[model samples]
Target: MAAMIGGAKPADAGAIAALNRAAFGGEDEVGIVERLRGDGLVAVELVAEQGGAIIGHILLSWLPTIMDGRAMKALALAQMAVQPGHQKQGIGGGLIAAALDQARAVGAEAVIVLGHPDYYPRFGFSAALAGNLASPFSGEAFMALELVPGALAGRQGSVSYPAAFGL
Candidate 1:
């Protein structure tokens, strides 16, 4: 069966929240998403649907990072989740790929994600510490991928996600 991937509409509010809760095992991330949405920092929220049911979701938000004494627009990939029944079917991968494409279309230089090292590497993410980037939590969980040529070249700094992320 083919899955349909697209940006989430306002009408998808409940489905998005439910996807998050199932993915992360709680409502905390759902609240963070709601806050980001209300604060106008959500660049894009994507959902994957199969058989008329939402099964996956991903969120991209503005993350400010300084490189060479200048600030640049960075995208933070967060809240990626797939419904329990849909796990390991590439739904999450499709959602992430779509979100990254959207980010690139908007001219975001780089993208950062806090996720499993093994999983994100497939998407071209590597240890951000090599580029002098670190997250509020730790260096290991932070990863980055340059979407444009030399986007991460000479970039170094702490990443600041939207305040709604509570990072």
Candidate 2:
């Protein structure tokens, strides 16, 4: 409740990386984010700020998807992290909402994510929606949301994540 979600600035990179390290207890996420930027795959990057400090971060990147033999415009909710001290305070949800809004604003038709099934569904992410899409990740953890109505309907094919994900 104390944090406001907004787009991340270049100057906030170090803080974002540090927050990712603390949230995930490792450097893998941080590396993925950096590589996303370097590869020009970044679609949206949002941060949660409270008292002028970055408390959370979320990144969405271009996801290469082929559906029904045609390419579709999609974004991937690549990584999201809330500072350990800031978890469970609704910051993560806020980031997801805001990031999705931004993704839509940027003309993305759909968004996919590999995340907790229980959590992402509240925002309309569904493994069933991603069911026909092939990816390195599958099962309930791999989900998708159609920002534009019926975007994923009757579509079938594979999704390729940016090389940064190493998946």
Candidate 3:
């Protein structure tokens, strides 16, 4: 909560990469972030900064989806990360809250995420909402949240993440 939450600028990519690397203990997520940026798939990017240093990041990318062969675009929340030292300090939650506000402001319909079942629902993501969607990951870990009520109503099909996701 001590950190200032703001939109991530292009110049913060290096610091964001380092933060993701430390948070996830690998470079895969960092690579994903870079690729998303390079491919112009990112819809929203947010950061948590303190002491003039970037300590956390959250990115929402455009996800192309089909429901019964019908196409509509949605947002995907990916690689929400906080520096190891900043874990458990509410930075991740703050970033998510800010990202959701931005996403909603931009008239996004819904957002999907593959994350901890318990951790994400607190932010309105629900496994039941993602039930009919097919993905490479487990259903329990895949979830969705509607920015506007009934956004996902009666929809069922697969999500095609931007090519940058390497899916």
Candidate 4:
């Protein structure tokens, strides 16, 4: 499949919400994503398109953390979803890569994701807990990646994602 990864356009909102609902097994995530977009908190919102149709979506939002008494921009990878028929076809991966690239381009210090450990680690994610970072929920599902050398150095604190996450 030939897929193009690009930033979300205004026209893509409905399609993106549909993909999110289908991929996440509900509509709750759709609202959260929309809210994030409206609030200008989405650092990067990427979509995977094939043949002029959107098949996958991913969102990275501004998650702030106070470490060493300083506030820093922490990229929060959330709501990654590929259409049911498009799963395992690399659309999800493409979306993630695009989002990460955008984050790096903008000089984000670190990225955090609450996702499947097996899948995210392939993209350089590691257990945030090991680095003294904690989430509202406990487990290896919460992970982090430092985008710059020593970006996470001496940083130890809890992550605070947007309230829309309900966490």
Candidate 5:
């Protein structure tokens, strides 16, 4: 059977961290996940499991965005990774789909990500949509997706991500 994507449990932290390290070839992602969890900033986290082992992971965290003088509730797709051996099998895409769905279900108005210019647009993320929002990371790699239509229609604003991001 294929791997199944589901909400991560507290017990899954160790496995998720390990997978992040393995998939990213470093500890940056692991540390980010830990800090996010420690700071109580994680809004949604999911894992892909098969044969009782986690092979993929994705996380969304609370992001504070102010647009047109009003605060809007948003989420950030902080990190996503799939085990090296599973990279091309669509597991990562599944994790993204599930994460976005969970983000919407939790009432996030929009979600932001700094990722591949070519890869993220397929998921409806658009740099043009994020053009009005200012962040440390900009240009094509930084994109936004609105879970609620017209949620991000604003003249200009800035996003303040949690301290866990170290930005």
Candidate 6:
């Protein structure tokens, strides 16, 4: 059956964790997701379903923008996973696309990701845009995408992950 991308249902949590485990071969992301869920840090969550079964999950959580101990608002892309059998079949890409649309619709200024340097830029995420920003995951993997034109321009600060991230 063709996969459908949609907002996650409460019942999908178990399947989401399973997909994360299968995709990443670890429980770290699942634990983080649980923590973020409990802490209300999840700004967006998308899931892919095929044959009435969940197969992929993606989340965008809120991250504080910290400059000299002051806090602002931002979003962070986290814990994206597609089931092992579904990898590279466009499910992950679709989930990202849908999430970005929602983010822009919600007036998110920018979105950050600590993800594959190669894989994420296609979605308009740029390490250059995030260059001056400080974070534990800085380097090629740390990237930002402007939902508003030049959202990160002249904005230099560290990303403050919520307690759920253990940062």
Give per-residue lDDT, candidate 4, residue 26. 88
- In candidate 5, what are the lDDT values of residues 45-149, reduced to their tens digit? 999999999999999999999878889989999899999898889998999999998998999999999999999999999999999998898999999999999
Task: Report the C-alpha displacement of residue 140, candidate 5, in angstroms.
Answer: 0.4
The TM-score values for the models, in the order shown, are 0.94, 0.97, 0.94, 0.93, 0.97, 0.93
Model 2, 67-158: lDDT tens per residue?
88878899999899999977898999999999998999999999999999999999999999999998898999999999989888865778
Q: What is the C-alpha local distance difference test score of each model? A: 0.83, 0.91, 0.87, 0.82, 0.91, 0.86
lDDT of 6: 0.86
For candidate 1, write residues 35-95 as lDDT tens digits. Answer: 9899988877899999999999999888887777778788888779999989999998899
Q: Give candidate 5's error at residue 21 in angstroms.
A: 0.9
The global Cα lDDT (0 to 1) of model 5 is: 0.91
Residue lDDT tens for model 6, 46-119? 99999988898999998887544545457999978998877889988999999999887776778999999999
lDDT for predicted candidate 4 compared with the true structure: 0.82
Relative to the unseen true structure, what is the C-alpha lDDT of residue 73 in candidate 5, on a scale of 0 to 100?
Answer: 82
In candidate 3, stretches whose alpha carbon ends up further than 4 angstroms from where it belongs are: none
User: Model 4 — TM-score against the truth?
Assistant: 0.93
- Candidate 3 lDDT (Cα, 0 to 1): 0.87
Better of 3 and 6 by TM-score: 3
By TM-score, the better pick of 2 and 6 is 2
Cα error, residue 34 of model 4, in Å, equals 1.0
By summed lDDT, which 10 consecutive residues of candidate 5 come out lowest? 158-167
lDDT of 6 at 6: 93
